[model samples]
Target chain A: MIKIYILSIFLFTGFFVNSQNLKPEIKYLQIINNQNNKFIINDNIRNAEICADSLFYRIDTYNNDVSSFFLLLSESYYLLKKYDLALFTLLQQRILFYSDSINIYSKKLLNQCLNKTNKKLPASFSILEKSLDTILFVNSAQKVDFLFSITFFINSKNTKHKLLNLITFYEKYFNQNVSFGMAKWKLLNTAGINLKTQTKYLLINDFNNPLSDYDNQDLLYNLPIKLKNKILNHNT
Target chain B: MFFIGLLLFFASEMFSQDVDFYIKNQNDNFDFQKMPKEMSFDEYNILSQSFRMQDMMFGFFVPGYVHFKANDKKTGYALVTLSSLSYATFAYQLVWSKNNLSDSSFFYNLNNLSSLSSDLKTNTLIMGGALFTIGSSYLFDIIHGKYRLQKKQNAIRYKYSLKASLSDAYIPNKYSNIACFFSMKIYF
Candidate 1:
């Protein structure tokens, strides 16, 4: 009994000391997450509005985890059915995090927005996509798989007639674009094997690695016999 | 229900392969393995909060860890079994799906194409359903553990929140548990 009492006192004091020393940023993140739970999962719009406001104020665009804030904000908007606002928020995220074209989460949210909308994508989206596509070929992000956000966007249920034409154009454009390794891994994967080779589009290679990159345009289009042999063989 | 949803969200967050991959691809400065070299007391104090959050997150990552934490051994063991079975089922299905795909060939023929799409849809739906079950068990474990801990905390807090004025002192044998007894009571 006495030991239990001592242990309890130790824990109490530790908690008190810990609470007194928490970082304001960290504390605010906790508060925001709790409020997000109330709204995002619990479906409390009032709390969602409050959460969006709190998140909006605290977002440090320079912070690495700032995407989480942007995502949460967009999600709050999504629940509120303000999809255009959601897409606009994600557009800002896309432009700011220019190097993160491979981020599937943002793309998925964008897909949800596009599927739910009746209108054509704003001109800004076109302008942004043009610039981002340039980044994709020039300074290719290393961590990206073959699946880009546009893949997700393409798969979204087309609500606009203009969007259908755009998807068809994109389909022809990206047909030959996935990394060799990602394409092979798809064959090994359950869903990948089921879908025809043409349907698989994701960013799956590190540009830094020659083996993964397949820098030669022709080699990128067709996986070379030697590349196949090296992968299939246990020893390189 | 609210707590269940919260636990499920964290459970998925803790277990998501995509998030794991994303974290690996992100900058290395956030890695917890290496300690920061030579920090002031301020940084150290702030760092301690991360460790505390990590302590909470540990409960999220490990199946039944929270239940064990709350001292419900029976429930904890049950959760462990359930989650293990859930993982096993998911793995088995994945393996089956791969093998099933390998055994089949896609053809441009209309009949074959329709069957292939249907098979793909069914396989994916099965995987999604199994994942939902796995997530639920993890959710249950966390909620039960937290609820038990909260119950204990409320009991302790209630005792501590009571306040009383010191009064009728050591009246012999009046109060056996203490040195003195209070006549006037205050409740908060």
Candidate 2:
């Protein structure tokens, strides 16, 4: 009975076309952390306004990653329905100067803000899912940084060269940043810490414990070789 | 990627030697002798069943269902948590709604409803985010699961091939190019 009335209403009131194809209009961008968790960001104007004020207070506020302040400030603008301000804030980091910056959340928010304001997409606005657009032009200094990064991934000898090979592969196959991260230098420090923790575990555990427990990539398979080396080199 | 890989993948990607050969020699890696074991259709039902796009598509709706099927529990749980938090935002928005406007009638109260409330201007930001988490999670699962499945396939192939070397039952007799077990002809 209720279904029939609903159908009749739809038929009479020009509700023939389904309007599902439109792009999403969620006003604010998500605050996705490294763990893939979205922290419940308070959209309170006072907090957001304070955040913007605090950004100016420190050349290195918000955990010393100054880039994050832009995201917070832009996100504040988005929550406050200040779409133009959001677009303007995010664009500066994305295209104007920090092109080398790996802060993708800002780029993502830029796209959202662009849509909110019904503006044309900017050149800096690439789909944020995973475009490591600038990796192909890596300079010598960045290439060296891969050695420290590579140690976090592989447990093999000649890790430095292997990282280079992977970087080339990333350019050839992925054409993106090594990690799908938004903040700068976080991936390196995190990977380095994980590797350090695992290395210490392997040294103390008499090569019996596994490195996979430490979240080191594929190190479980390589542990046997290291174990054998430790055994062979052990002095009585 | 339309967006990714992590550290352990270096073994799959760059372990073979120089960059030049890695690209040139991808074919060499495909050699049957070195090929990962022929995974039984049932063994990797996920890959074998991917021809059914419906199943893969449905997996996306459940948010991490594909990853759970892929046996990547760590990632699967993360996605589940992400989806839950994403949806929970809606509940949060409802309790603390800035506007009196609620879309409860968007589905149930359609007779009185004339337009879609789930648009860019809808006061609820959570509605837009609902699809984003699930969609991204499913896509990530597909990429991560592909590598994980391949790695498992390679591991099993190496294990069985090593066992076959001593067993002689699966060995290729030099007189015949075809291997008894794999039934593949050696080129060189």
Candidate 3:
């Protein structure tokens, strides 16, 4: 009878400990859900921050998938214009999630923060170069978004060579996907705008500038109009 | 049946795992890598505000004014041309008539110098008024066009600046030192 009593006691303690461990995880999850709903549904950053802070408090620092939580926190900070803290959080995300995809996103976020701080772009393009192949192969909307971002950054910095390379990549992408659609229209519009901006830049820098190697005046003028017509027709 | 349903509802609430289940499901589908790395809301807001200001300054009324002024220029030019031509013709007629009245034998015999001078003065006054009106209108148009162009150029030339400062002030023997201060200023 004593042995059986001791066995029951051990079983009770084990279950209690298991429940205790499960409670925090469950609480953390509930807090995360509340945070996501607040942020995504209500668009309430303040409430989301409260829930995120609650989750952070409960989360075990030693062992947990902290990347998602860190991403949430950083995004909130970013929206709040606390960029230094956002940058620090992203660095932590990099350390935790050392995947190539995360690295690309982290670098992109870092670049944005740097841009906002009026800092020069990092001289090394190694991260972007390494991720280019993988990004190209990914059949997702992100492919266009990533290309657009790089193009926008290059245009702002007036980096001609990198811009040309991105343009070439876009041409290749268009050729690979021949079906005319909204995505294609968006890409065409972006390219046209970038081309027009580049021409303006050239005009400002060199009044007596010779003809540009990439300048197909006909394409430059017609492509944007064609894209607009396509969009209008699609919408109608 | 209602009583049973209420009891079941309370029981389900007591054992609810909906939040946990939803979070787990979301985790399964969430791809952080695919998330867009866009600019901060504050930066985007500032950019959009500046764009709105630019549109307000240069896009709406300014463009309308420029187009209206351009059309006005064409009409004003035509009016000036016609008025100048008419004035020149009248002046020439007055000059020729005056010379004839001074030299011709018929006018000398008629001795109508007062009438001839009166007609010449009337013609000169009309010519002078036409010249003044056309000249002033043309000058006004020129000045207005110049002002519009200058306003447009100023609107287009947007500038932005960021400044940061740190300072500490001390008045030794007179007062306590001021604490170190830091500030950042952005101008657009």
Tell me the whole-model lDDT of each prediction, alpha carbons only: 0.46, 0.44, 0.41
Ranking by TM-score: 2, 1, 3
How well does candidate 1 match the true structure in TM-score terms?
Answer: 0.25
Clashes of each: 8, 5, 0
Candidate 1 on B21-135: residue-level lDDT in tens?
A: 3234566467544222223343333333211233347755677776666556798888888777777776876787678765442222223444456666566556566677778
Chain A alone, TM-score per model: 0.33, 0.28, 0.29
For candidate 3, give the lDDT: 0.41
Predicted structure with the largest TM-score when compared to the true one? 2
Which pairs clash in the backbone of model 3?
Answer: none
By lDDT, the better pick of 1 and 2 is: 1
RMSD of 3: 30.0
| Deviating ranges (above 4 Å) for candidate 1 | A1-236, B1-52, B102-121, B156-188
DockQ, all models: 0.01, 0.01, 0.01
- How accurate locally is residue B53 in candidate 3, as Cα lDDT from 0 to 100? 21
lDDT of residue B100 for candidate 2:
59
- Per-residue alpha-carbon lDDT of model 3 for A48-82, expressed as tens digits? 33433343333223223345555555655566565
Q: Which candidate would rank higher by lDDT, 1 or 3? A: 1
Off by over 4 Å in 2: A1-236, B1-51, B91-99, B102-123, B166-170, B173-188
Any idea how many clashes model 2 has?
Answer: 5
